[model samples]
Target: MSAYKSADQYRDIAGRLALPSQAFIDGEWSAAAAGKVFENLDPARGTPLGLIASCDGSDVDRAVAAARRVFEAGDWSRAAPEERKAVLLRLADLVSAHAEELAVLESLDSGKTIKDCLNEIGHEVPTFFRWYAELIDKSFGKVAPTAQNIVGMIVREPIGVVGLVLPWNFPLLMAAWKLAPALAAGCSAVLKPAEQTPLSALKLAELAMQAGLPAGVLNVVPGFGETAGQAIGRHMDIDAVSFTGSTEVGAYFLKYASESNLKPVGLEMGGKSPMIVLDDAAIDDTLVSSAISAAFWNGGQNCSANMRQIVHTKVKDAFLDAVVDKAKALVVGDPLDPATDLGSMVSEEHRARVLSYIEIGKAEGASLLAGGGASAGLDGAYVDPTVFDNVDPAMRIAREEIFGPVLGVIGVNSAEEALAIARDSDYGLHATVFTQDLDKAFHLAKRLPCGTVAVNGFSEGNVTTPFGGYKRSGSLSRDNGTEAMDQYLQTKTIWITLK
Candidate 1:
């Protein structure tokens, strides 16, 4: 026997990590009014990981009240940029110091490989904080046109208290995306993590507190969407709300904002992103590699996964053949196994959903090139890496977001047709076009209606680059670069005559 046969045999040192269990309100761990609890499950084996305190609408009210008090206090907001940067810098240091514990907990909660989580997500955490810290001091307002002695100065001020809702797929990374910019911009926040993955966010709150963040500055409440999420959406005291999740949930937040406070809503929603392979594209290893990248990472759960493959008709068959061969080689098994190339879906329900979509594709007469079933001999949730050939642009598989390990191959007669096929989706979150022609690459890159485009390269970016979708895929306020700070800030103008 190779060490422990099952995950149960290996004790998760990460779960026993010391972190506060109470709802972080007013900068401390406080219990909910009802003190109700909910169980967080390990999706890999469908086992209980831990019981987290559940927050209801009433608890959200209290948290919002606390956040508003802190925002109004202006201790952190009105303070100098250097002071804010110092606090955030300290928080980043603490995160780096506890990197291993955080990585282990993330892996345990999300069913991702511990190695991948530690290497990618854990390492990126500190960089994000450090990047935002440097930007804080350099960020300043602009002076607009004014007549004569009348000066029009547009200054960025904290946008009051914000309600940040994070998805389960990449808990800490998404939080870092939202939290770093929001905190650096001097906004107090009430954060609600996905009910399924609350451990990391709870742990994060503890670290933030330890890093000298004052009470009521950052509060994390773990609860269900209907109760806690809806409460945050409609909360009167909340100045804004930033969310990252499915298109349906994102739509609901928008409607709630419209009906309630007419507050600004920042959403990073679903994506049916496309990858275009042009006629001039090299038919070698790079083509195969891009195909694998589109529909494999995180079991293809990424919002920007290269789910839709728009290939030139000249090399369409050849590209599809290469992709099928590469995809079939993927090894699906226990997430802890270092050799496992693919991991489980977030949950059994999500696995079933992915499978159902595959069935729908078959029903619509799309050719199943490879992997249309669950992997055999795996006790945990494991779906085969799927690929559909001869898929029509109009098919549901091509139009909608599967959020699974499925790739849709669409054949186009020309480079124009390829770009057309790629753009013919409601989601413009991300797209990649592969071609050796620099003119064609740059031309398609500008013409494609996505928020971010990659020519020759697949979906990629640093914490400093802006990442969001266009049209229905993302909101105006959630871009990730220097502009990200704008989401948590409101422009203010202060004018005075010479003393």
Candidate 2:
């Protein structure tokens, strides 16, 4: 009954894109130094898309060397801010022009729904570049007041070469989050796309070259995290590394940085975010839809996905029933289908991990209200939208990051109990509250120890606001908005004595 594209249609789309397979370095595409390659599979069909270059530490070294050369040459690093802005704006235009191609590649590569790929990845990717491009000209340094005729000035400068490690979910969008700000600040970068999803990053690198970015300004290396990622973290020449991945890997980046160059590392790591529905909430169709979307969007692979849904004990049963009904209604099938509400997980390995977590949830005494398994009749890595009731705050599924389409509902006696339940987590990236009471919304918003809290809605944030986590969810620096540029910039103080 779904209006999904056939296999042949998808294949024709793929052929038209002709996505790049080689790693992009110094404005050119080339094979890995060792000529090793890895198969990139379409997660929905489990078919091989192509073999991508499998880079290693040596490739990372080459990329870093090239980036360093460009940084020293001042082609981009010393260019005028307006000039950098112009190039980024042009790149944004190119991204818009090739939106359909990129959307096809993204859905095929990462198994995200084609609708989301086009809207979130394809359309939103250019916004980051354009936002940062316009912001470049506005982020000026300050002239500070000083004692008795002595003039002091503070100026921001790029931190030389940077290393960026991206995650599998929202590949190109996440890349834009880091890439836009770094380039706007005049920093050269060596980017390592996750091995599972590297096609879009490589494609973006090609587009950057076409947009007039100087050679070495942006480089993409695709490989295993243990090799290229570790090399980037440990490389003494890489001034800083901005990473978005697991908290465990984030800790490793810190260790590598400390053990090597002691470079400043910025991490946008994992999250076990929560969504609280107060008894006084509107409880309309919109509220129910938002709750379901928060848990199942992007197949729940989002780092900031709300895994825990805390509800008032009074309205718990009704809310649970509505959520369960909605979960059961989701269409899980080919991601390329415009009507598909849910798509495959990023890979078979990840699907297995999510399935195991469902079993664990059942074993831990959480009642499975709706679904706890893969979709019926689907050969791909498709997981049904799952909801668990009576999930204990102490349970692993409640406390840890599942990174799937699994929602754990916990009932609370009062607002106090809800606050306690939401705060008791190692990860604090994003949370949402559904309530009509203004006082209650602000009260909960002020107390939640997360980086962002949405009242009466569930969205990460807009371009103007900053995004990052508290505690283990992220580093001191934030991503998106004007604050993101700070991560790639350093300040210097200059003082002059007047006669």
Model 1: residues with Cα > 4 Å off, grouped in runs: 1-12, 15-21, 144-148
Of candidate 2, the 10-residue stretch with the lowest lDDT total is: 1-10
TM-score top scorer: 2
TM-score of 1: 0.94
lDDT of each: 0.84, 0.92
Provide the RMSD of all predictions against the true structure, rounded to 1 decimal.
Answer: 2.9, 2.0
Deviation of model 2 at 381, angstroms = 0.8
Model 2: per-residue Cα lDDT over 79-139, one tens digit each: 9989999999999999989877888898999999888877865568899999999998998
Per-residue lDDT for 324 in model 1?
A: 92
Q: Estimate each model's TM-score.
A: 0.94, 0.97
